[model samples]
Target: MVFSCLLFGASALAAPAPWYLWRSKLDGQVFCAQTPPGVGWQRVGGPYRDARCENTGVPGK
Candidate 1:
């Protein structure tokens, strides 16, 4: 639909989020990173939704 394209375009133009909230499956430790989660990591919430999620991008740390 036209609306879908518009929405996708809008999102594509937006600046990259500073961090992405992620949670560790091993210990349930929540943190933030600059990219998608690696193994053993899951997204805790949306990208750039909350500024407080920003943290070191290192995984499993």
Candidate 2:
């Protein structure tokens, strides 16, 4: 029973958080936009001009 509990905890720790991307319209650059479970979308970058946000599955390279 102890081993099973440990295994379950490890599995939960290994889970990856879902992430999205927010792209900049002026410069055509993308930024990390993580929803963070129940939280709303947030822009990772400092600032940009007329920035348009979008939810993308992959991160910027």
- Superposed model 1: Cα runs more than 4 Å off: 1-14, 49-51, 54-61
Task: Give the per-residue lDDT digits (tens) of candidate 2, residues 1-61.
Answer: 9999999998876634445555555565655534432233344543222223343343232
Off by over 4 Å in 2: 17-61
Which tens-of-lDDT digit does each residue in 1-61 have in candidate 1? 9999999999887765556788999999987666767899998764454457644442222
Best by lDDT: 1
**Whole-model lDDT, model 2:** 0.47
Compared to the true structure, candidate 1 yields what TM-score? 0.48
Model 1: lDDT to the true structure: 0.69
**lDDT per model, in order?**
0.69, 0.47
lDDT, model 1, position 44: 76
